[model samples]
Target: MTLLDLTAPPSRSDRLTALPVAIVGAGPVGLAAAAHLVERGIDVVILEAGPDAASSVRAWGHTRLFSPWRHVVDPAAVRLLETTGWTLPDADRAPTGAELVESYLLPLARLEAIASRLRTGIRVTDISREGMDRTRTRGRAAAPFVLRTQTADGAIGEVTARAVIDASGTWHSPNPLTSSGLELLGLTDVADLVTAPLPDVLGRDRARFAGRHTTVVGAGHSAANTLLALVELSRSAPGTRVTWMIRNASAIRLSSSTEDELSDRAKLGGRVEQAVAAGEVDLVDGFEIIRARRDGDRVVVVGSRRGEVVEHPTDLVVNATGFRPDLSMLREIRLDLDEIVEAPRRLAPLIDPNVHTCGTVEPHGFRELTHPEPGFFVVGMKSYGRAPTFLLATGYEQVRSVTAWLSGDLASASTVALTLPATGVCSTDIGGAGCC
Candidate 1:
């Protein structure tokens, strides 16, 4: 598809250009995008589907992050927070997801400049041109973007914007148990036994996992965190057993090169390896899940391990198999996405997990993020598509460029200015997802 022309002369008053830029999600990246737009004197409205700001991050608030405060906060966000007497957290310390929300995101979102323009409990369902579908191209560039939104009270509304930045992260949609990407067999019948990704295994969800057999499927920082927590739980709760399963033969690798700038991230992998050696957890390599069904009170999981079919019955199963962007909402909008990774065609090559690590992904900007649809961008974790290892520092740079381009500062948008932490986990890990 041909790119939409942004320079087409407007009809009469140019009403579309006067409208505010609509930003989806009030998460870290979404708020960062708003901060940049506000700094440029561009009107903006932030729509958050949850009842409070940064709700998705708060869902896994119990888990501590590997990245330090210095690497997580955006420069524009800091400038905005400093105005309202908000001080930065200790740069050397890592915080739990809850601390991140309370210490930074909420403070930035509550600023008068941001709070007045923010609306929570507003879920956007669809996006498209004001008066036509993707098939209609004439005058599309100048047409105001229309958004279909539903409020907390079930009231539906339409929001019009000159541009849209979809910083909605991929925390909501999780990969299923099967390696083939098909729905888990008999999933609905055994739904109660399956827990969502990143559950509070040692806290709120402790009773469900304590003193019972629990199987964790995936191999990434997220899985590492849960295993460590579960191992700790086993110490106190008798009869508690933890099992680790992975699709590949090698469970997880932390570069022994010591070149990693993120020490805490490396430590997580090291801790898991130690637990496995101590025999605190059961490790099953090269397992492909074929089916799952309810067997009395326990759920029986059937899979092929090294070409031999195996069945394991457990009380609980944690699906930590990473995440994917929810693209159903943007079906009417034109997009150029890579089939393998689902990221933008220009960006997929740079971030494809098959070839690059977290530190290997170079900085990208508006040009790499744009689709055939003009004034539309997918920033943050969602922008990386199915590929993992997304960082907040990277996202901060994304919106800085996206908002710059939207505000007509082409030079700033084209310039790349971002540096990420070095990591040494061989190849991409679709089995696990992470963002800090």
Candidate 2:
């Protein structure tokens, strides 16, 4: 039997008949989707708004993930990495946002799987189905879905596909704390409080904040990280003072109660304890920021805490607030949305049991694809709303289910293959770097 050349490009006319699947946002989810399709011999096209795989991570490059490297690396992606002889990091060690994207995501794209299919620097402006009567030059069947995008070369183009998936992450947009029970503590415009590129408090700029009073608002991982950095900064820059102003009675803790020691809430609680004990930071809880105004060189933060009004003089206000999904692209596609979560209400069922999909060997976050808009799915943190705790493993499962659904093989796809390798009896024998 002769080996087939699977990498040849199809003729231009083949575009009319190619089973095209378009994926938006090239974070872990979109990349996983692309890998899955290629593995199944399906044609896929991935449109990424950024320059590369971890652009979103690069945007928040200054920060590290709450979970370790093990949680962020997609299992199927790991297998693909093994094919290229790359050794993965240990599961216990969490990587920074920059390392996760640069180390894992970019390398996978360079592999034979789905490399040519990726279109970078392509921003998706809108997604919608073309009318059935609309023709490809006046006399053809209307495409099912169209993605309007602007290319890197300043070229505007449209890609029509049988299905579309949105894997854009949390940085789509920022979520103001005011939306989550914090009153305006007198600051009208929150954008001007800090400098751009997001300050790395513990980074080289530690000297700038030293000996100065700083106010941090919000209670998520961002706030926690900010506080931790400030604490470290205070040690060297003894002139810097830190204050964590929260609307809640205390720092917001992680909801997972499964672990007694490793829970995020517990860790954060400890950080708060250390900061308070050191006298470098103050925790002013149960306070609602009422207003803010510039008085010469300092900012006056006024609010009411526990029914008592209070005011504080500050140097800077860092909003470790939160993020929201930028749905501007989906403003055209109509789907059943949850009023509160603002995600697809039907998305829960797809990942509820955590089944696999075809294009990738991971569990997917298909719940975000709740509408009857078959062939479409949403994965990654953006699909989860303001809540965190998404694992890359969950994204892999999502890809498995989605690819299976795409290829019309969902049920059989869930069952992992039991076939034995002819020579490599154990996984380690085949270029064993321990991924087995």
Candidate 3:
């Protein structure tokens, strides 16, 4: 009944049978993993940290995804949903985060196979072998994984599984405002003035920016979204101002949207271009922010610009700098992560932002996602580590292959069946700005 008991064998010579796979995070990829594994008759248990599925996605519910329904919805999940007579949304129409949850993830979670196996309001704190630490190797592969979890009521519990897939994304961890990738000095003092990367600016959070001079940081799509929202807010609420800052010498890096295969992504670049041309948003180029402090009612942002110290005083700061994976939880698990990207060593090159564009990155499966640990994988946006070129379609393919391998379908696991659209641009300088 317990995970440790499952590891106990009739004899040392007998092969250990695989137990149910435990998936952390109930976002799109995590739920898709459940769908695929369940279809294969593999027992699955999903642990979600929030009250419902796609909690992180719900946080930025207002923003529309660049990819349409066809790209975001996993095929395995669709098959499961179809059995229940679920109606599919428009394949070509892009849905906002809210629509994604309501129309797809929500309905998929309601399936009898998934709903019964899902445990909401549970956070997975740590994962390791039942009887072995990272230092011990004897019987390690045979021992089931022990996941330490915390419930909403503050109760601690443990669940054991034959395999683990970390689909927990990087949304909760945003990069710091500093150009050095570290926290800005004196950031805590003015932290109250900073907003999340994707705030509901046009909705509930409008009053916060209506008539204030807000400075948006970073060069990614999230930043672009915030800038556009601020521009819209300024039109209705005069006296509202928006200032854009980036470490890049110029905003030309964002010009790639014009050449992107996806029309929605291209339109984002066009909108930003028009905003800049019309002087609707102020551009602060080459601004390497290094420090922050509160100045009376305003926050003073201090940084260096071309060897000279520069300061910008503003009422609010939106830190749209991207996110990084939380690796601390897996410290006791053996992970062969790349030195730079922090992704699996074999997967780093294919997704390296320095060389491959989003589309150019080859289709990968179980081999690329595997770690030194026998039955553990990092998928979804978390698998990309610091690289910013992840797409929902990529994560769907990942779980598909991982589930196949878990179910003993070696042939299906080895076949790379994913194809993605390219950003039409590649650069190492893609620093935290762009769609996931």
Give candidate 3 misplaced runs (Cα > 4 Å). 1-18, 419-436
RMSD per prediction, one decimal? 2.7, 9.4, 4.5
Better of 2 and 3 by lDDT: 3
How big is the positional error of residue 294 in model 3, measured in Å on the Cα after superposition?
0.9
List of clashing residue pairs for candidate 1:
none
lDDT of 3 by residue, 1-436 (tens): 0122212112221233546789999998899999999999988899999999988888888877776677778888999999988878998777787898999999999889999999999999999998899989777877888999999899999998888999998877778899898988998899899988877889989999999999999887788888999999999998999999999887543544555666676688789879988999999989999999899878999999999998999999998877888898898999888899998888999988778556667778888888878788999888989877676677788999888887777788888766545522211111221232
- What range of 10 consecutive residues in model 1 has the weakest lDDT sum? 424-433
Whose TM-score is greatest here? Answer: 1
Native-referenced Cα lDDT, model 3: 0.81
**lDDT leaderboard ranking:** 1, 3, 2
- Candidate 2 lands at a TM-score of 0.77
